[model samples]
Target: MKNHLKSIVLLVLTSVVIFSCSSDSDSSKSANQFTIEGQSYTLIPDNALLELKMDNHIMDQGQTYDRSSITLSGLNGTTIGTASFDLFYKDGLPVEGTYTITGSLSDNDPDFFDQLLVDNKLCLGWTSSCAVSEAGAPTFLVNANNPTGTVTVINNGNSNYTIQFNGNYRKYDGNFEVIGTSPVVINVTTDVTIQVF
Candidate 1:
């Protein structure tokens, strides 16, 4: 009887441990990670490289849309890269919804967000390999292939946002030649109170 009771208690403890661990896996960004050009990055709640800021509403095509600028960047000693985009909503303030990341940076659609194509020399940095153009700007022979992704924002009802990034960004050269690609998957919970504009 004693041995049987001990076995039952151990089973209960094991079940509790498993349940607790799995319950909050998707609740935050700590469990999510992404890789870019063979460099891996993990999105933590307070990382400097992950940013989501509210911007002023803009008028486009006779309609006003709320805007939010997002930036995700990281470095791995030798190389540094960044992805930037803006979210626009035609309705009132931004709400919890999954928005598509349209590759067009100048898109006039009031209900969609746009991605700003990043130049390899500017956004993807390899200090030693960057070439300066005649305009005194560093230029790269490559750029991203107009990354497409989904941005899912969850408002915690407390001015906090839980954002998720799942997309693909490929490398393309100035001659439109394909070089490489990387899958971007990140999750970040950030406070927008300080970034409200």
Candidate 2:
């Protein structure tokens, strides 16, 4: 009877261990329901390149969006303006992030990578290459000087994003504002979808 009881105890312990392990293993699935159709991504460059609405370029960028850098933006306190973003595959999951740009110095003419790094290197300069600020916000070129502040990633689809550069600034074009504030912060929301075959 003791042996039988001992066997029963061992069985119970094994089952408990298995249940414990299974519970822990199941937690991995508790994450958000992130799905990728296959391996395709939609990308929008924050630069004038996207402004032109060139079909060919957009197609090309999407083909290799994961490897390339593209513009990305989000609303500040308020939320308006659209910042283009690139979505790609990482570790079997679709990931998206912003591209850091240094605009060219001269408005008259620009060289390759025309935008020079800001003195602080936080923001890109004003130029053809540097993506323009939201349609109307007050924005000029990098002014041939590095931006003082750095831009940060407010949020990420995957990990809890930490702040990064401070440049991709908000040029007020007199768009939207807070209820009471004169020229409140711009609120932005952009959603990019990726379809993989």
Candidate 3:
């Protein structure tokens, strides 16, 4: 009876270990999921891209600033979004400072569905006015009009940068003329750093 009891205890311990490992694995997968406006989405990290461009120019008032353009793409080469802003610099180059870029989606712009590319394919069809606002120098904010949220970008210097989308909200049409919200969080360490020069 003693030996039988020992065997049963060992079996129970083994089962517990297995269960713990499986639970951990499942939780790890869930970590990749994010809820925006109550809708959950699994971010495809491999399909993200970001590009930045800088141009120095003098205004009519003889003030010099750097005109910067940022473009974000996902699911492939589809342009998810773009922003343009001017930054004042003392030496014809943008100093390490926080800058803001704001723009609105016009009727001539591409459809929002075409912009949201996932795995080299379009996700869903959405049409709405989206205003983008982003800042630089540490903590950043990428917010839009319809569905509002923040996006963070980190510049590691040497033209290397990282882009993160956190709880970004977007508005879309649901069934029966109902409007819905979709929030997304995507953190991607791009293979190629966005070069700003």
Write model 3 residue lDDT over 153-174, tens digit each, in one string: 5566765445454443443343
Order of candidate numbers by TM-score, starting with the best: 1, 3, 2
Model 3 accuracy (lDDT, Cα)? 0.38
After superposing candidate 2 on the true structure, give the runs of residues whose Cα lies further than 4 Å from its correct spot.
Answer: 1-81, 85-99, 105-110, 113-165, 168-191, 194-197
lDDT of each: 0.49, 0.29, 0.38
lDDT of 2 by residue, 25-58 (tens): 5223222111111111122223211211122221
Q: What are the models' TM-scores?
A: 0.53, 0.23, 0.36
Off by over 4 Å in 3: 1-47, 54-62, 74-150, 170-180, 193-197
RMSD to truth, every model: 10.3, 15.0, 13.6
Question: Which should have the higher TM-score, number 1 or number 2?
Answer: 1
Off-target runs (Cα >4 Å) in candidate 1 are 1-33, 44-56, 73-83, 108-145, 176-178, 190-197
* Candidate numbers, best lDDT first, in rank order: 1, 3, 2
